[model samples]
Target: WDSVIDGNTSMEQFLNIALINAPLEKDYTILGQVLGNLQQAKNYLDLMAPMHASYNSKISKALSQMSLRMSMESYRNRDFQRRWFDAYISLSSHGEALKHIQSLLQSKSHIKGLSIDQDLRWAMIRQLNRYDYGDAQALLAQEKHLDQSDSGEKAAIAAEAIRPQSALKRQWLNTIENNDTMPFSKIRIAMFNLYPAEQKLLSAATAEQRFANLPLMDDKGPVFMRSFAAALIPTQCSAGNINAISDVLDTQTGLSQLARRALLETRQEEQRCVKIKLLLQ
Candidate 1:
């Protein structure tokens, strides 16, 4: 494998070596280790388009056999299950991947008091969204333990609610407003796009106004600046607040290059719109 990665050995030669040294017995541990190594190799090969599909068959076979041998207890671990699911999804279509995930979800017993892995849960949510939004909402409704305090879970739930077919937009807005731990600027921006009037109403209800009283350029950290810049630029453009947009463009301390570019584009577009309006008049 090292020789293959280092370009000393061809992939075909590496495959031949792997096949020749294959153990006769069905050892799950060894299979798991090999699967990990193959996954790494696949990542490297992904950069070369011609060689991308070469490892698909081997990876799929390993995942199938590993799934069969591994117990439900083993699958309860997030890292273990994520590796398997990610590999499976990479090789299979969305429908096939969802079918396999649903089978695993159905087979596991919550009576063991083990929590469902968050990655598995999020994967199901995402796949279900692709497959059926109604079914995804139903599943979300059934999940009683979704903690709003956990930023990841909150983000996932927010993502689900923002989907076009979701009817829980208002619920998600409330959840985002109440989440005091993480910055809500990103979520607010999403909500603003989808339900501007409702987002404005929610923003008014909250004491901390959206993107209005952000920390000064020197005071804020990178994360805060990024989130604020991401949220502010879009909102200002949409609201036709060109002055606010220019202010963001003038500030040099915290905004990322991407943010600056977006603001510049937005300002130019706004000016173009104004010129078009004047010409019409």
Candidate 2:
């Protein structure tokens, strides 16, 4: 595996051979092999999941720590680090995984404060809330320094404040309302700030019009459109209209596969909601 990772052996050849001959052991060797090469990690994990599921808690804990270490090493590339953390956390129980992630976030000596991105921090907060609401509240209290003048920080604040369990929903809504003339990017952020109930206030046509007027020449236009699609999911939009919006999205250059998947999921959710509403009526 080391030779393969070090470029001595062809990756495709090694992967083909490993698919047939890889040992199903819960050991550091396998963990190290997967962590060392990102290209092969997903395939290797898929191959090993059946065997690895039988491992005892101790081996699982060790692998989780190793994954965290690998993510820390990739901190310079925030997107890659986030992907690593997301992949690692998805494999473990949410409660246990979030507890570990929260500990790492709170440990200032281990990870520098500024190195963490607001999106990643908010993702952790959302997961923490999923597992333990009180703990998430306490974390928000302790991490008040997350407040910044940037749009990302504002978006995070709005999202958290509008959460069903949030104590400051009214205050956050007032803050957003007071800033009516914010730029398109900031408006995009504010859209994400809307709660499910608030989302019903948006018109699908209004969203589509706003999206149409976006200056694609601007580097942030595609990003804004992506966020717009996400923010539209909980709104009272017709599935056909959502599909039309998605068709518009498909024409944008440089939009990522991740963004495209999010748009598709949003459309599916809209369809599901329509079915549920019809069934209830």
Candidate 3:
């Protein structure tokens, strides 16, 4: 983040690294034949990239991204035409980013020809929905009509929960905090979608409720709360939010070790976000 803000690195590079690290952070290397295995992954992805068109099966593309990260290369994943999609939305004005996204969705994306991958399509919709776009429901409904699989159902639930509605935020908060019996599959998606860092105003409404839910998360144990705790952290690029999260870490001793570590890491992420905003401003 500092490197990017200081003009020592590109913003797109920083964003792609962050995206890769989220999934590839722990034990990311093979102990033996690391390069050999990595090369095979690279070979498979290189061979498979051209096959990824209407093929919603993202293993090929996803594997390619992972292999690129492992190789310390930047993620400009190739499409059928090898035409890239700058889908990460640059660190620019929100409206401008939305405009670009809207154009891509409208164009069905040149990268994939006349067809867009199902997962990629929903990802675009979810981004619009996060800003509470007026057509979120209709757009999500349209996509759901196209994909009736289990993955579709989960994505639809996440899209609905992600709408920037205060009531929906509050309702999901209760479900996350109180509904221990809810399957992790359901709750994890809800947790991940419910509180995007930019959605601080919506998050503010239930910020205290989330903080208070820490004990419940700890009681649920590491398996349930490890990812959930980090997901629901009410993060923003502001000192007030940072200190509020920090205070919980400082004074809250009942939290289990994993939950505490998750909180600390998330706080660090927010701090990095704060640095990016401050330097850019």
Candidate 4:
């Protein structure tokens, strides 16, 4: 009955209830009573459907930007993306919802206070990647400060995140570090500030150097911490491509085999390199 009343229940719950009870009710009046309950529940749902839509719509707007910023955190994850997908798929016009989140994340409060929680940041990053570089760069700049400040703890965070220099990580970090004309520090500082205290300091150094320089100093080798660091380091040199890459990495669907193939194919294209060059050019 709750399943019939609450739209939020998963399909599994519905099936489990039907399987357990459908056979037990053999009397006609009992069956009719169940049918009446179902009809009444349906009426309630019909009344509340619009309200659900409105609620999710509001959540989607807040989440989209929050999720984008979250994607840049040391804790972006698939579960966060799944929630965002749920909110997004329910909307009739997602554009307003997306921009609302983006605006909040990019607002002064999110950048300065790091109030955009992990789940919300994950949602926004998924949305931010759909736009062009200018938009993505704007998003990264919000949290770049978190990536630059390198205290002892910050260095520890970097060691965990950037230690294993994948070929892609090495390439991207090298490009950003040496790009004197673009003032990588300014750009990355903006990114770091978007993070909470420790993360803001850690991400800066990790984002700056080539992967070769990022080995951990021993004591912080937990699997998830290291995996998170490696994955969060931008794979593309330009903020734009990096943001797009972030979008792909931010969501479960975005990380699908097809998405990986697209990213790999993109990496193979030298034109993308030229486009990155043009950010400074």
Candidate 5:
């Protein structure tokens, strides 16, 4: 109580004690006091001057470190809630993580100024395919269009801006909460796994065929296929052809991974069969 009111104690020490003893061993009603102390400390540090120029640099660095520590501590607390949603999905065979993210997106308050990281956005979208979050879906589609239209880093950033959250997201959440009678989990897993590869393959094949038919057909077929290949081929693969396929395989849902592994196994078996045939011959 003395430390809370005195403003001499570090925020870390106060928060640590509150975490351990708050509403448990003690009434723990000092949150506002701690925040006020922290704000005051920040203001003081901002205005304080060190004796030497070198010391001023050191002081600024230390203040930055302290601010980073506080931000990390806050993130840790937020992380606990995210982990609960992740576990709910894992155990219940529904997409709780997706729904939670969708809810965040739907509420401008939650997503405001929250620069969703790229990998996080991808994971959220991938999960959305498993469930429903209609707003998220529309945003993602717009994001995809923007990505397709832009080039270079701007394109990548545009792609990362939209994420998956669909109406199906809440349905999956409900299924998980209600113990998964719907069993759409398996179906969701399969679709997410299969679609990326199929989409890539379809685009590649279409472009190639279009290019081939351009020479054979009359009505500006040559121009059409040439432009089609130019415009469409680039987005189909992130890297080269092989890397794109591998990326899709690597990022697939669990069921997709299983299918990919099985396909690889079968291909290996076929190679072995060919070698055996050659040896016998």
Candidate 6:
């Protein structure tokens, strides 16, 4: 909070907490800033990209898109909302929200649909696939055919990978840790989509291993570790999980400064979430 008021927090720190993408070491600082000033909301939303949580946020329309896409991502969650202002706007459940997003692409009785831009269209498709909705593979193929550009190709690759199958997810975890030759672009896609909040089974299955692999991941160097820490580190909002990671941090001497920062930041974020979970309870 002091750092935010003093106006010297790192940009990454601000963006991650704002988008609710992952935890950072000083999340509360930027969040307090966001609470104090309405304009700081976009500062919070800037980290979500390539896999669309809330990246590049500024406009209300952009937030409306994310609200529909991201709401109810976790079926276990109690509320469907996003907060740009002091109060959050209520949102619909997954199926209902998807229907509304789908309507924007085509006419719906009384509503004349507007043609959504390609990136936003892909964001919608990615959400649909994450929820394992209708004919996801076909949707990817059709969109890939429609665009046929480099960005489209990248989106297609990510869209295909985000489908929630245990076997595919296991394969991705291995690939992320071992495939050094994999392009950073694809790496970002895999990391971001591999563990949507809704896919507890996938994230839960490998949560321990994700932590265990930190040393090897850090050895890959900072560039890789930064992206991995930001996106691949699964969000486990439990005191036990936080303590487990804390134990590793307390004893693990092999982790680099960057890797250590990642763990600590994740710890702080998890702590904040734990408080919120208790309140919700």
Give the alpha carbon lDDT tens digit for every residue of 90-187 in model 6.
11114554566455433351111223468756776776677676656677788989999878977886776788889988898888888868787887
Of 5 and 6, the candidate ranking higher by lDDT: 6
TM-score of each: 0.37, 0.38, 0.64, 0.22, 0.25, 0.66
Model 6: colliding residue pairs: 1-29, 18-44, 48-55
Model 1 clash number: 0
Off by over 4 Å in 2: 1-82, 86-93, 108-119, 129-134, 158-162, 166-184, 193-230, 233-281
CA lDDT for candidate 3: 0.59
Worst lDDT 10-window in candidate 1: 195-204
> lDDT tens digits, residues 1-281, model 1?
56554445665555455444533325556756665655544433332223334454454455444443332334555545444444453333235445655555556433132344665565555445434433566665554245444545554544465454434544554544444555555455444333321132222333123333343421444654454444333321122446756765675436556556656765765554333223222
Model 5, which residues run further than 4 Å from truth?
1-74, 77-97, 106-115, 148-192, 195-281
The backbone clash count of each candidate, in order, is: 0, 0, 0, 35, 11, 3
Can you write out model 4's per-residue Cα lDDT over 68-181, one digit (the tens) per residue? 343334134444333323333222125655455566556623332234564445335433432321264445444444545443233223222222224533344444334446
| TM-score (C-alpha) between model 3 and the true structure | 0.64
- Error of model 3, residue 173, in angstroms: 1.7
Among these predictions, the greatest TM-score belongs to 6
- How much is the lDDT of residue 77 in candidate 1? 58
lDDT of 2 by residue, 7-58 (tens): 3554444444543342232354563345444333332332233333333233
Local distance difference test scores for all models: 0.45, 0.48, 0.59, 0.37, 0.35, 0.59
- For TM-score, candidate 3 versus 4, the one ahead is 3
Worst 10 residues of 4 by lDDT: 210-219
- The residue-level lDDT of candidate 3 at 40 comes to 30
How many clashes would you count in candidate 4? 35
